[model samples]
Target: MLTNKGTLIPIGGNEDKGIEDNEQYTLEFIDDGILFHVVREAGGTDANIVVIPTASSIPVEVGENYLEAFSTLGCKNVTVLDIRSKEDSEKQASINLIKAANCIMFSGGDQSKITNKIGGTEIHDIIKYRYKNEKGFVVAGTSAGAMMMSQEMIAGGSATESFIKGAVKMYKGLGLVPGLIIDTHFIKRGRFGRISEAVAQFPQLIGIGLAEDTGMIIKNKRCRVIGSGMVIIFDGRRLKHNRHKILTEGTPMSLTGMRTHILSNSDSFHIEKKKVKILPIEAPFI
Candidate 1:
């Protein structure tokens, strides 16, 4: 959507839920934390928030976690829409809730479950439509949910098989951001080789590797980093002497001149411009 007016917050797994009542963690939650940003972006505490836990195997528990998290943020109008199957996505009540939502947050789980259930349904279409046409609309996701935002999604991969031809597996995603391929828990999960192979396979698309408890707020082609960890950018647009294409499956591969950028909180990446705006050392914490 060239003129899309919505916002996408794709979080890496294990974001602070503000559940700990301890003083220090609570203070962290209050001051410019990731969820705080989400609430602020979705029109404050009064925003009509819908939590979709369809991707989780334990939807009930995950849904409740979000309800509590939002409550801690002083958000009262939160509803969990547990869409377990395709039939659930077609429910009129589900559709109504989605339409009324100022923001929709998808919980972490299996990305395939979300696409299998909601990909072609009315709920999915409504989200896409509202995201493109409505200003201030927000769609947020974590882990598997984050990975589903791109057109070419990485379903699963092995970090141990570094540079191997068949190291990563790809799948069709929700197409929310067609130009990106998102991978979560990158730092902790040791997924550099996974995303590295993915970028080599599709040199045209940019690969985003989000570390746990970290995320990016993307709008108007600008991806701004947030949270406590790092975001690795693998820009394969300028790759030279690529060997992945010539190698057979399971064969070790290599590439030269594949650009990489490691960023932390407050740094911004301009998707179309292929430029990075790093935060200065003296800037105040946002």
Candidate 2:
């Protein structure tokens, strides 16, 4: 399912941060930088940003980081929803915060933690509702947060180790978007093979590999790459052969004809059309 109502930003891990003079941890000082794209997508300085740190083990610390970052960005209404358990996820207060937020940002941590705690909860339902029905709403996440944005997510395993048949294990995600799987810290961690294996296994699903400091702004099933690095897309629709059906786990996989593309900043790709636009059309004549 795709919606043109809201924006979805899935950022790779290692976002900029710093420590304040007061000894409190916060994001690095910079005007309209770091999470500038996020702020802009959520209505800028006046945006009401809700930081969900459920995926992080250090929820309090991680939550504070986001709060400080958004606050420093001139977003007066910044809140951190530290959901540590399934019980906390279903709380009315939590649901209310999510419903009222202009943007919901999932912090970096364990993707499984988020799915296990918030999946199927009232808060989750509210998020889905706002994303589908409301306008100007934004959903953003980094690392594990990014991985969980799709219908199917890569739970674990590196590219090298998961090169064999059935070696890659995927888990159900938030399903904010379906028919795709996302992998973060891509190039730095050499995750191309992992995402490739995932595509080979599920040829119908598109695989996205996001490098650090890079991300994709997805709207209505169309994706635009952003940040300093690249977004690798593994399209397996032309897959000629894969012994996945007959091979067992750990067996060498034979995959062929998987088309791949590297998208840098400003590049856009249409999920349905499977086309890439390298440059934006500019206004002619002044």
Q: What are the TM-scores, per candidate, against the unseen true structure?
A: 0.93, 0.91
lDDT of 2: 0.80
Instruction: Please give the distance, in angstroms, between residue 16's alpha carbon in candidate 1 and its true position after superposition.
Output: 6.8
- List model 1 lDDT by residue over 77-196, tens digit each: 999998988999999999999999999998888899888899989999999998888888999998888999888899887888867899898888888888899999898889989998
* Each model's backbone clash number: 0, 0
Report the poorest 10 consecutive residues by lDDT, candidate 2.
23-32
Error of 1 at 135 (Å): 1.3
For candidate 2, lDDT tens digit of each residue in 117-218?
Answer: 998888888888888877789999988888998888888875667477665778889988776789998988888778887787788888888887887788
Q: What is the lDDT of residue 164 in candidate 2?
A: 74
Off by over 4 Å in 2: 1-4, 16-34, 280-286
- Candidate 2 lDDT for residue 24: 29
Native RMSD of candidate 2 (Å): 3.6
Best lDDT among the predictions, by candidate number:
1
lDDT of each: 0.86, 0.80
